[model samples]
Target: MTIEPLLKYMSNYIDLTSDEVVFLESKITVRKYLKGQYIVQQGDICKFSCFVLSGCTKTFYMDGEGQEHILMFSIEDWWTSDMGSFITQTPADFNIQCLENSELVMFSYDIIEDLYREIPKLERFFRQIIEKAFVASQKRIVRNFSLSAKDQYLYFRDQYPLIEQRIPQYMIASYLGITKEFLSKIKSQLILEQ
Candidate 1:
């Protein structure tokens, strides 16, 4: 895949001049990763912020009991990075793993400041992206506390219809904070109700 997808996605937020685009192309790196490969692992400092040109990835952390709690899933045009680690240059608490053979456009944190300096709107574009992600995260937290498991599952299905088909049910259950069997039962009940 090419950086065209990323450039196009960015256009939805901010227009880039030809010179800015050329500068971006010079600083950006594109890489391919096979399924199950990790782009960032827990405890390692996240050096790059990546945008998916194609395919999917999961960001999660393993608990003390070795249970994995998925934070989010990112597909095409989505951004993935441990923001805390990337911004602070600290060890990451999450691992980002490819769920399919993926192509990503990565911007190194080292060059981000310079990019922002040269392309001021680029910083605004990222700010908006982060703002949307933050709002979604806060909404998810509220949903977890306020909604029943079945309602949460329904909401998830409605919000991520594309994702529901691509990801395994068990992983979806894990993301919903419900057991797989419980998720199965919920799906069955929904079908029966229909």
Candidate 2:
């Protein structure tokens, strides 16, 4: 692959010179995974911060009963990592698995720190990205408390249009914190309303 998507993403926050782009490209390693492959397994150290060039992955936790709870989904152009584990070089609390055949560009911890020191503008870019992730997470928490299940599903649909088609229904149900049967009922009601 091409690093254009990453370059474009960076350009939104800061102007990158040709030399800087080359330097960034040198630090990134591309890898591909089949659907169902685990990028980061729970209890393992997450070695890389992954940027999705194509396809999707989900970060999730497994409860004592072995129920999977989705924490977040990273689609094309999005980044995914166990930030705590990656930064601290500790075991991860979550699992990251590919939901589709995916291509990712990975940056190791050392590479990121080097980038920060070499191109300080990247510090601002990452800071903004982290801030936005935090805000989105906070908004999700607020919506979980404030919105009804059906409304929450609707909001998810609006927020991630076409995502429903890409992933399994049960995964969507899990993400919305609802039973699959409840999600079906909601879909039926929406169909009737339409």
Candidate 3:
């Protein structure tokens, strides 16, 4: 994986000095997880923010029936964490798991906070990322409520095309708020029409 993309992405928000970049990079721990491995589990406080360098992860919440509803997918360059737990230092209500063998640049809460203080530009960069994420979540929620399941799946694939190829159909169905059976039927129908 190229650090160039990540550095460029960060540059879009804030200018980083060489020393600051080096310092931030020094604090990051490169880690890997196998598919189906839990990155953050329910009841565990999220102490770190994981930045995906490659592979996919799913954030999901389990229901009383033991069914999981996927809230989001994190792919290359995306950040994954149980936000509530990270921000509040409380037990997580959701789980984040690797959908594929993955590598990430992980930063602990303390490290991030320390880096932010040392590099004021980093704080600005994080604020920008957070704002963008918030807006995207708002738009996603609106689409989920207003769009049909098939439409939602289609749009999600269109938006995150790489995610479609990397993640499982069942998990994609969960993210779309539809049953696996229903999603399979829809896929079959679409293929037949094509």
Candidate 4:
């Protein structure tokens, strides 16, 4: 795996100097994970911030009755980590599971402080990333309250056009906060309307 994709992604937010690049190269590690592998399990401390080089993963939490509620899906070029756990070095409330064979570029929590100090622009980049994620989360919450189930499915389809094909229908149902049968009915209604 190469860090080129990561460099390109970073460049979108901040131009990296050669020295910064070299430092990052030395600190980052690339790892491969197979489908069904757990990158970060609930109750485990998340030591790494993972960036998807290829493939997809789901970040989720289980309820008291053991029903999984998917919070988000991370695909190529997206970042995935249990932010609360990674930042505080506490046990994670969420689980990150690979949905496909994946390659990830990871940065350890141990060196992140050093990286921020050495590369000041890196802090701005992460701040912006966090801001965007926060905004998206807020919007999702609003949508869940304001939209109907059919509208929610449509919105999800428009937002992640390729994700429907990549993952299972039941997984999408879970993400949509609906039963698989309801999702199927909504989909059928859409098809008939079309």
Pick the lDDT winner. Answer: 4
Which pairs in model 1 have colliding backbones?
none
Give Cα-based local distance difference scores for all models: 0.93, 0.92, 0.86, 0.94
- What are the TM-scores, per candidate, against the unseen true structure? 0.98, 0.97, 0.93, 0.98
Name the regions of candidate 2 deviating beyond 4 angstroms.
Answer: none
Residues 84-181 of candidate 4 have per-residue lDDT tens digits of 99999999999999999999999889777788999988889989998998899999999999999999999999999888889999999999999999
Decoy 3 TM-score against native: 0.93
Checking candidate 2 for backbone clashes, the offending pairs are: none
Residue 126, candidate 3: Cα error in Å is 0.7
Instruction: List candidate 3 stretches off by more than 4 Å.
Output: 1-3
Please give the ranking of all candidate structures by lDDT, highest first, separated by commas. Answer: 4, 1, 2, 3
Which pairs of residues collide in model 4?
A: none
In model 2, the worst 10-residue window by lDDT is: 1-10
